[model samples]
Target: MALPTLISAAQLHEILEQNDLVILDSRFYLTDLQKGRQQYELGHIPGALFVDLHHQLAGDETEQTGRHPLPEPSELADTLMNLGIDSQTQVVVYDDMGGAMAARAWWMLVQQGIEVFVLDGGFPTWQRAGYAIEAGCNQATVAEQRLTISYPWLVSEDDVVANLETERFQLLDARAADRFQGENETMDPVAGHIPGAVNRPFMQNLNEHGLMKAPSLLLEEWTSLLQDIEKPIVYYCGSGVTACHNVLAMNYAGLEAKHVYVGSWSQWAKRILRKIDEANA
Candidate 1:
């Protein structure tokens, strides 16, 4: 299936009518913890379920795994069943900031082998387009949660280390240039990125208003970044969350769907020998 990383507002409006479609609102702010829930409480897309960054999207690995760590598959499967998602459902996810946070949930579902898509521009763009909003939460009864757990798409730390020797896949870092360069080390003690990750800030996927830029532009930028490689791409961020945004953008730009480094910087920080910052002074 040709899964477009983004679906237009008008297109989403049409998709909403499908009974088997599941919409997840992933609107979140890194600085403001309460704002995303507040926005969801105030109004959200009709029949959309909310996935909070701190609560549902990740597990309790704040100290070890940056901010968000991959949730246990059984636990995540339960959450999905509660949200009315099954293997057959077409899931749509969105957030306020381009798709940084939303892409986390998108990648999570994809890792679980679920076919999911991201709302290209996210909630703000939906609002800007004058889309109708509705209040109140939606709940569906679940008889039992049955998940066909699939986790083969991800690459392991050993895989990353081995790939570093051969450039098997392009390591894309979806973090700010400052963070990628090890200039700022506040988030994690050890600065610098994985051995050969090229920086591609998640924000580059969006416009000033938090909507995705044109596909042609995205293709051009990613093309420049991947010029030296002839392998599948892999992405990582502070945790595993924001990197999914870059994956979504690359997918939209007609790039291959890449692997996500779920443990990301947090895990890498724990092992200092793995810290290679030659790219930065």
Candidate 2:
């Protein structure tokens, strides 16, 4: 059987030279956009290409759309191709921040039905294992491939708005507890979350060391969380970025996470702020 999409450091190191494998370094910081690239330039896993969250994985932000609006599937497919990913390629992505940022890349690819592996415990684990590291920019040979998008797994802002009245899906917030409670309002100017969304901070999926918890433990936690809720689960975060971490966690725990509010709290907050401004105007 094939390895799951969350591969460990040793597993990745063992298959580094496989012809069909492609490794990506996706380290990023929410406050400092350029920091990730600076770290990658210093050192990265051998043969790993760097991918920026905003520039590559996401599209330009508008006043209405969230901070990290997703790129079109075709655009992402082009990005993968440009990075030397072919149809037969096995892709693995990692970041220093555990799987938080890397999961964004995984979601974008997985939405298009492409299976992507996130480096379990991410770059820190690799470093701890004393794997080979290379510095500076590594050139990626362009690949001639047009990827097919056979699966779409997102709910639009309109859908979310409609759900408020219908209560068709369960809203799960992936922000920190304080942010969810309208207290630690740091990232976004608007405080609090969507009216009915429940809090499940993305970090809950990880242990004290910032590594993802075991699958069985995750299974227990997720099962208990979703125990009485019969509605389909929908995940969201400040900018629809870290929310993917929850999606990855749920899937890692063998739960089917088929929906994401791509625009997430960013878009929702933007909309609400616009309304408040209009009223004040």
Candidate 3:
């Protein structure tokens, strides 16, 4: 049987010595991009390679694009090959932020039809378990074969707008409740959400101890929110990062939604604000 979408630290420890396993340290901060690498150099899981969220997971940003846009499929495939990832590799990704950033890599890889899992409880859990840690970078030799990405899992901004107009799908925002309610405006110029999006903060997927909730529990929570709505559900976050966390959780709970808004709230808000500015000008 294949491994589930989420892997425990114990399961990872058991397979840590396996040659086919590839662990990635995805520790990242939205405000401080270098903090993740700095922390990785201080200490990380043994044999784990560091993946910078900004450089590797995201693409160049512009006023029209979200803060952390999805990288070009071809570019990301090349990067994965350079990192020694191949078709047969079993990839495990983790971050300090309760799988927020790590889930992005997991989602991207899974979208490419690659088998990958997010480390449940993240790096803090491994530390709590007294697992061995390594310092400095561990670069893998570039692999000869490159991976291909087929983004059947992603939804474009146009899809979001159509969903809003047609109500053909449910739109879920994974941002914090306050942010969703437009209470605290910091990340983007606009305060509110994409008009009809329901706020289901991604952090709610985790327990108070920061580990993911049981699949049964998650199923109940999500099912209730979804209710009788039979349309395909779409999820988004500030810049499409944490939204993957919700997608991972839903998949673990057996309620997988393949459509994710890659540009998310940041791009949506920007476009709305720009249109308003243009209209006034």
Best by TM-score: 3
Off by over 4 Å in 2: 1-3, 149-151
Ranking by lDDT: 3, 2, 1
Per-residue CA lDDT of model 1 for 1-281, tens digit only, reads: 54546777889998788977888998887678788888997999888888787777787774435467766777777788887888777889988777788888887787666778888678877888899999877775452546755556566567776887887887888889998999977878778999877888988888876777787999999899788777788888888888888878877887777688877876778655334443343
Off by over 4 Å in 3: 1-3
The TM-score between candidate 2 and the true structure equals 0.95
**Candidate 2: worst-modelled 10 consecutive residues by lDDT:** 145-154
Cα lDDT, model 1, residue 234 = 81
Each candidate's TM vs. the true structure?
Answer: 0.87, 0.95, 0.97
- Give the range of the ten consecutive residues with the poorest summed lDDT in model 3: 1-10
TM-score of 1: 0.87
Q: What lDDT tens digits, residue by residue, belong to model 2 across residues 1-281?
A: 22245989998899999988889999999889999999999999999999999889888899979899878767877888889887777889999877989988888776655658999899889988898889999888888777864326777899999999999999999999999999978777789999889889999999987789998999999999889899999989988878889989988888888578988888998899889999999
Per-residue CA lDDT of model 3 for 1-281, tens digit only, reads: 23248999999999999987889999999888899999999999999999988999899998888988878889898889987888888899999888998999998888666789999989999999999998989988787789876678788888887876798888889999999998898999898898778889999999998999999999999999889777778899999999999989988888766678989989998899889999999
**Model 2: how far is 14 from its true place, Å?**
0.7
